[model samples]
Target chain A: MSILEFSNVSFSNEGKSILKNLNIRIESRDYISIVGPSGSGKSTFLKLCNNLISPSEGNISFNNKNVSEYNPIELRKEIAYCFQMPHLFGDTVMDNLSFPFKIRNKKVDMDRIKYLFSLFSMDEEFIDEKVLNLSGGEKQRIALMRTLMFTPEVLLLDEVTSALDSENTLIVENIINKLNNEGSTVLWVTHNDEQSIKYANKLLTLENGEIKSLEVLK
Target chain B: MNSGATLSTSSLIIASSLVLISLFFSYYQKLNLEKETIIGVIRAIVQLTIVGYLLNFIFGLKNPFFTTLLLLFMTTNASFNASKRGKGIKNGFLISFIAIGIGAFITLFILVVSGAIKYEPYQIIPIGGMIISNAMVAIGLCYKQLLSNFKNKREEVETKLALGADILPSSIEIIRDAIKTGMLPTIDSMKTLGIVALPGMMTGLILAGTSPIEAVKFQILVTFMMLSTTSIASFLACYLAYKGFFNGRKQLI
Candidate 1:
């Protein structure tokens, strides 16, 4: 079963088109990597899956139901997204990590957070540490952890590791790749050609707001 | 004691001599403010003269409808000017009008209900003017601050939404911050009321020959009124202004 399907989806802002007549199906557990030029609407394409942006034309369906039919907040929970430059709210790492649970009025799962932190090689003390004092790589890791804390059915990565060092990047890629193998579909957007080929089972190439080519890598 | 003393045209012109000092400074210092200072003084004279007669007429009539109409006009004018400060928010006039109107009306209603103020033109007009104008400033600050904060923290907000968080959870901190910025001036002014400088209400009442104790009482009431008005107005403005930053799809506009 497909987790996400975009059929003839096109989005335009002001007058310029961002994505034009995009057609794609993201099946369950498929690890897809999207590569494109800077302005080729890679981020916009990821946003469409969660309905962060409604298509100006055509339709998007998630789990066989039109995305427009689902409540956006609920839909977003099932399809988590992370951006290129991570933003951590509040003062401490706990604030960012516990937010997903906080919004749901659920208690924070300390064990889960600790395990995820250890997987990312984060120090146990870093959980209580202020986000303001963290390095860029640390902030990015925290952001990724926050997204994975909920364990969504699908994860959207918008060049989330772009600002990280190779070491941190590998940690992130390893975690995301592991999650993908664990039955969570992944739509990873990256500029690193080697990383895309290695992590993605299916590769999508976009140019000028449309898909130029798609290849089955593995 | 010179009780109920009034300024005649001759006395006013004598007072005008003080402004000449400013004109002189503008000339000697080459400040290039000579024309502006002269025009400002003249404009104040003309505007105040017109307002004096208008107030005299309104007071004599003692009609509730007329007083209410004038209050609305003042609120509208204030809202119009305040809305200009909110460049990023759409329909800022409506936002400011609702904020100021609610803050001023609720405060005025409380004062009237408690019999602290007589609902007469002379009592309500001045009190309402202060409340509405202060609320205007508060809302303006809120609108500007909210817009700027949201713009600056766009990534933060978008990141949360992308994480399946709703608008409120995403931007709650920024909302609180904007409200604080909006209320800062009023809070600071309240803190500095007697030590830093005397407020206008107390000074005016004293000049009008009201007892010092009475003047202090009214000043305290006005100060309290301002604090409440600013908080209410800024609160409303923050809620309304934050909406402008997001769309129906919950994306940042």
Candidate 2:
């Protein structure tokens, strides 16, 4: 089933087109990477999917329903977006991890949280430590764990591993690859061609507000 | 006991000197003063003259109705100013009203119930002035900080939303920072109250024939009240103002 689709989508800011006549589709469990040079509208495209910015011209549908008709909050729950720079809140790591569930009025899932912590090789004691004291790698790991806690149907990763070191990058990649394999539709945006080729089941290359090519992974 | 005319002349001279000195400093610092200075001076003259006359009337009227009306006027005006200062914030008026109303009410209640002051017009007026003014500053600062934080950290905020977090907790970091920054000025003033400066309450009491010790005691109360009011106002304002930035659908507007 097609979980996400963008048709004839065009976006403009201050009278300039940032994305023009762009179209794309993602099926269930498809691990797709969007590659582009800097300022190629990659981030903007991802934001459009999440309804952070509405399209100036075009239509987006999720699960075959027009995205414009869905409540933005509901849309966000379906398609989660991760930023290049992870922003963690609260004084303690546990506070950061549990914030999402608490805000939604859902009970905290300790078992799932613990499993995720172990996956990232984070100790249980780190949960009590303040997020302010965590290094960049640790912050990214926590951010990723928090996002996956609710298991959204689609994950929009906006160069989330760009700021991490090689070791942390590998850890994140392995985790995301595992999720993709387990039937999560992933739309990742990155500037690294090598990373795109290594992890992406399909590739969509963008340049100057347009899709240059779309190809299946060999 | 001396000539009223002489005292009035001295007061005018002191006020004029203060205005001139402030203008000179603003000019020397190259502050943006083209229209603001003129407007500020006019506003000062008009507001002070009106307040002077109003205070004189209240001192003699001794009517609770009139005194309560004056309190309402002060709170309304302060709330309006706060709302205006926090432009681009949706439902700002509601937030401002709550912040100013709650802060002023709680402080006034403490003063009256504790018998620290009598339930007279004069007492109510000054206490209301202090609480409302401080709350106005607090709300204004909080709104500014929250908006700027949202602008600069857009990416981070979105990341949290994507992670299955709702808008409130997703923006909690920014809101907390805003509240802290908003209350900073009040906190600093409290820390420097006696060492660096004498606040208006202390100075006014001294000029009105109170002993230095008595004036200091009153100053301490006012300072403490301001701290309490400012903290509450900023916290409430930040929490409420954050709602304006995001729609009910959890999308940033």
Native-referenced DockQ of model 2? 0.47
Which sections of candidate 1 miss by over 4 Å? Answer: A163-168, B1-3, B28-30
lDDT of candidate 2 over B1-253, digit per residue (tens):
1112234867886777777777788788988673687798889889998988989899689998898888888888898999898898888888888888887778788888998877678788888788889999888998888889999988777766666457787788898899998889988888888789788878777777778898888888888888888888888888888988876557677
Please identify model 2 stretches exceeding 4 Å from their true place: A68-71, A89-95, A104-114, A117-142, A160-174, A194-201, B1-50, B91-94, B113-119, B212-217
Residue A89 error, candidate 1, Å:
1.3
Grade the docking of candidate 1. medium
Per-candidate chain B TM: 0.96, 0.86
TM-scores for all candidates: the values are 0.93, 0.81
- Top-DockQ candidate index: 1
Q: What is the lDDT of residue A101 in candidate 2?
A: 81
Task: Give the lowest summed-lDDT range of ten residues in model 1 chain B.
Answer: B1-10
Model 1 chain B TM at: 0.96
On a 0 to 100 scale, what is the lDDT of residue B88 in model 2? Answer: 85
